[model samples]
Structure formats: structure tokens, C-alpha cells
Target: MRGKNVLITGGARGIGFGIAKAVAQMGGNIVCLDSLPEPVEEFKELPQRFGVKTHYFRTDVTKESSLYKSFKDAVDTVGDLHGCLTAAGVALDKPFQEHTWEESRRILEVNCIGTFFSVQLAAKQMEKQGTGGSIVTIASIAAQGNTCPGQRLSIYNMSKGAVKAFVGPLAVELAPQKIRVNSISPGITRTPMTAALAIQYPNLVKMFDRVPPLGRMGSPEDIANAAVFLLSDASPYVTGADWLVDGGLHAGTSRSLKDPSEQ
Candidate 1:
């Protein structure tokens, strides 16, 4: 990732920030776009801390107009856009029956629609530069997990499925132009957005012990590393693929362990 100019949506915090920092450490410039002003203000120090150029632009991922402005701002400043990490998104955890019309719409508008618009804008910018680029998204294990009957996350799960469908064809459509599109599906990760929510468990560590063979939740760095690979030349032949960084959670999604007596 050295000498690369990268832009990440929803990069103010969480996995986006982690990705930003990771790339910065590797001698890559970073431009982050988000709806919140605080993230931009706080991210101002990343340049000094990571010894790489870093900038933050405020953009609402849900709105094309706002996203356009934000992306344009990044282009003007960064000079060359090599890739995009469209990780900006919103999560709605609600019962399907309790999901108000507004809530459902808002989730899709940001999580799915937001990703689509960002990818289009980034692809166009990269095409104009003709430098060939990588576009990665922060997807979820939910897309594949819904086959089981554990969690009731219908909207989030469905949207991720949509993200895969949305990114694959574009990967083909943009292949001729040299732009690679990919997604990373992460399981539970330790980020601010998930901190409080995951804390609901009395014994968080103990509870997580029941998770995959890894026996714990993931970290933003785990997903960030995958983002870097998808964005870097290392994965030049990898496009339209949803890379799973779920600590083997997907590999052992269901349990078939029988009682000790039966064994």
C-alpha cells in the first residue's frame, strides 16, 4: 500500500478508522468521509501519529448529493484515488414485526444504498484517473448466518446479501476498466459501536467463549487487514469476492456435538 491514496467511507471511527490507521502505517495516504463532524476533527492528528498524510471529509453515506460532495472534496485534496473502503453504515437491531417503515428504510438507505452510491462515485473517479483501483466494503456474517435460526436480524442480514449482489456485477462491469470490487464479512468485532451493545452480557468474555473455535470476538484490525489486501496489488486477481474474516465462525456456524454419553 505504499505511495497509495486511499479513501474510506464511515472512516471516522470503528473498523474504518482501524483500516485508515493500518494503511497509514504502511505509507499510504488516507481520506475518510463520514456524516459526523467530530470524527473529522478527531482524525486530524492521524497524519502525525501514523507518519502518513490523512484527511477527513464529512459526507452522509445515505444521500448521493452529500456523498458526491464528500468524494469530490477528497479527490481535490488527495490528487489521485487508488481505492475506497466503503465501510460507512448504520445498524438496525429490531424485530421484523417491530421494525417501523421508517427504520427499515433508513437501514437500507445507509447500509446498502449508501455503499452502492459510494462505489459508483469511487469507480468513476478511479476510471477517470485510469490508475485501476480497489473498492472494498465492510459487510457482515449475517448474510450467511441467516440460514440458521439463532438471531432475528432480518434487515441487516438481507442488506448484506444485497451488498454482495450489488458488488459482484459491478466487479464484472468494471473489470475492463481495471477497478476491483470486493467485500469483507466480519463477525463480532471490538469497536466503539459494538462496545456498549456487546457489554449487555454479564460475563462478556465467558459468553464469547461459546463463539467459534477462536473462542472470542474479532478486532477491527482483523477486518482492516483484509481491507488492505483487497485494496492492495496482492489481490490483483481477486474481485467480486466476499472475503470472510470471521475467526472461523462461519466454518462452524452450526453445532452437532452430541452428549458425552452418546459419544
Candidate 2:
């Protein structure tokens, strides 16, 4: 990926930041876009820190106008995009009965619609370039299983599920152009986001402690490495594939006596 220009959405920090910086350290030029203020300011240091060209764009991925402008800006800054990693998403953790209609739409609009815009806008730009590229969407293990009690996870799960569902058709559609479409479904990773949650609820930690086969939570680097793989030619033969890096969370937990769920 040396000298290859790539756009990373929600990339100012966390998993997005890790991937962007990792790629940069590998000699790839980065265009990191996120709506958050602090990350944009903080990420400015990446280029000098890693000795790669890195640009920052503040963008609301859910808004079409903002997305178009942000894409153009990223392309203008980095020369043109050879790849994109869409990591922007929102989480709604309220109980199902507690969620309001508007609340669900807002979350889905940000998570699912933002993902759509992220991929759709990138594809249009990639087509105009008439060159193939790679697009990686960041999903979660929650897409695969029921976790977190009292969580109004319907829309979050739905949005993530849609992201996984989208890869196949997109890959088939873009293969003629040599553009790759893939996804990374990560388990819980210790990021600033999850760190806050973990502090708030200790039982959740114990649940992950005993449930997951790996006996530990994931890290941002784990997910970032997978993102790098999906973005790099190392995965040249890969497309429309979903890679799960969740510390064995999806596999049923080991329980011999009474089923854990029943217990």
C-alpha cells in the first residue's frame, strides 16, 4: 500500500485511527475523516509522526452533502483514493421498550445510512476514476449474536447485519471494475468507547470474561490489522468476504452442566 491514497471514515480515533495510522506507517498516504473535533485536531500529528502524507477532513458521514464534499476533499488532498475503510457508527444501548421511534431512526440513520453513504459515495468516485479500489466496512460481533442485556440493540444489529449483507452484491457488482468489497465483523474491543461502558457496568465485563472462548476482550489493533488485510493486496483474492476477529465470541460458549443462558 506504499504511496497508495486511502480514505478512512470515522478515523480520527479508536479502530479507525489505528487502521489509518497503521497504513500510514506502512507508507500509505492517509486521508482521515471524522465528524469529531478533537480527533481531527489530534490526527494532524500522524503525518509527521509516521513520515507519511496524512490529511484530515471533518465530515458527517450521514449527510449526503457533507459526504460528497468530504470525499472530494479527501481525494483532492491525497491525490485520489485507492481504498476506503468506513468505521463510523453509532450505538443505542437502551432497553427495547424504552426506545422511542425517533431514537431508533436516528441511530439507524447514523449507523446504517452513514455506512451506505460511505460505500455509495466512494463507489461513485471510484467509478469516475475508472480504476478499481477496495472498500472495507467495520461491523461488530453484535451483528452475529445477542449480547448485552436490556439493550435496545434492534437497530444496531439491523444496521450491522445490513453491512454484512451488502458485501456480496457489492463485490459482484464491482468485480468487473476490479474494486473489492469486504467487511470486518469485530467482537468487543477495548477502545475509549468501550472503556467507558466497561467502567459503568462491571457485570458486563464478567460476562465477557466467562463467555468468550479467548477469555479476554479484543483490542483495536486486532481489528485494525484485519482492516489492513482487507485493504491490502495480500487479500487480492478476497472480496465480499466477512472476516470475524472476535476472540471466538460467535462460537457457543463452553458449558457442560446447565446451559449458561438457562443458568
Candidate 3:
């Protein structure tokens, strides 16, 4: 990743920030596009910590105009984009019947529409550069199964589902241009978003322990490790694929069988 410039949406915090740190550690320049008015304090320390160029732009992914302008500015500052990660998303937890039309719309706009345009802008720039690049979107295990367990997240699931569905076709289309498109479907990662969910549904904390075969919730670093591979040259042949970093949650049931003696 040396001399490469990777752009990350939602890079101000959480998994996105983790990816930025990981890329920086690999000697890649970092460009962060987030809705936050200013980059987080930790973002300011990237240069000193990793000796890499870091830039942050306040951009809302839902608006194509905002995304276009911010992306252009990022390119002007960082030179050319070699990799991108569409991590800006929103999650909603409400019973399907109780979900308002407005609530559903917001989730779709932020998670689905936001990702669509972010990837589009990145691909366009990479296409123009003619240098080819890698694009990774952050989907969720919820797209593959009911990850929330007892809680309801019908709309949120749908949004991420759209992300996972599009990567394959997009990869095929972009392959001719030497661009790779893929997604990472994470399961029950510990982020500020899930921390809030844990408060709303306290049982989620317990389920995190019992669910994944790894016997623990995933960290931002766990997901970042996968993003790093997809973004780097190591995955040249990998594209249009969805990597599940769910600690075997998608492989099979994690529940242990009861012993016959106990029964």
C-alpha cells in the first residue's frame, strides 16, 4: 500500500477509522470523508503516529453533489485514489409493522443510496486515473441472516442486503477497467452504533457471548484486517466477493449440544 491513497467514508470513527489506521500503518495516504464537521481528535494524530498524509472532508454521502465535490477535493489533495471503502451506514431496530415510512426511507437513503454513490464516485475517479483500484463496501451479517437475534431490524437488514447484492454485478462490470469491487459482511462488531443498540436491547450483550463460535464480539480491528487485505495488492485476483468476517457465525449454529449425562 505504499504510495497509495485510499479514501474511506465514515472514517471519522469506528470500523472506518480502524481501516484508516491500518492503511496508514502500511504507509498509505489516508483521505477520510465523513459527515462530522471536523475530523476526530485521533484523526489529527495520524501523521505523527504513522508518517502518512491524512485529509478529512465533511461530506454527506446521501447527496450525490456533496459526495462528488468532496471526492474531487480529496483527489486534488491526495493525488489519485487507489482504494476506497464505503462504510457510511445507518441501522434501525424496530418491529416491521411499527416502522414508519420516514424511518425506513432514512435507512435506505443513508445505507443503500449513500453506498451506491460513494462507490460510483470512487470508480469514476479510478476509471479516469486508468490506474485501476479496489473498492470495498461494509455490508453486515444481518444481510445474510437475522443477526440481531431477538431485536427487529428489517429495514437495516434490507439496506445492507442491497450492498451485498450489488457487489457481484458491479465487480463484473468494473473488471474490464481493472477495478475490483467487493464487500465485507461483519457480524455483531463492537462499535458505537452497537453500543447504543446494546443499551436499547440489553440482552444483545449476552447474545454476543453465546452467538459467534469465537465466543466474543468482533472488534473494529477484526473487520479492519479484512478491509486491509481487500484494499491492498495482496488481493489482486479477488473481486466481486463478499468476505464474511463473522467468526464462523454464518458457517453453522454456535449453540453447544447438551451432554447425555446432563440430560
Predictions in order: lDDT: 0.80, 0.80, 0.89
* TM-scores for all predictions: 0.90, 0.91, 0.95
| Per-residue lDDT of candidate 2, residues 98-160 (tens digit) | 878888888788778888888887888788898789999987887775663333577788888
List runs of model 3 lying over 4 Å from the truth.
257-263
Ten-residue stretch with the least lDDT total in model 2: 253-262
Off by over 4 Å in 2: 40-42, 148-152, 254-263
- Backbone clashes in candidate 3 total 0
Deviation (Å) of 147 in candidate 2: 3.2
Leading candidate by TM-score = 3
lDDT of 2: 0.80
Q: Residues 1-263, candidate 1, lDDT per residue (tens digit)?
A: 87899998888888888888888877889988888876735467767876788877778888778888888888898898998998887776556798887888888998899998888889899999988899998888887744222345678788888887777888899999999999898887777766655555335433443565475678888888988888999899999999888777778731422335523
Model 3 has an lDDT value of: 0.89
**How much lDDT does candidate 1 score?**
0.80
The Cα error of candidate 1 at residue 37, in Å, is: 1.8
What is the Cα-based lDDT of residue 163 in candidate 2?
A: 84
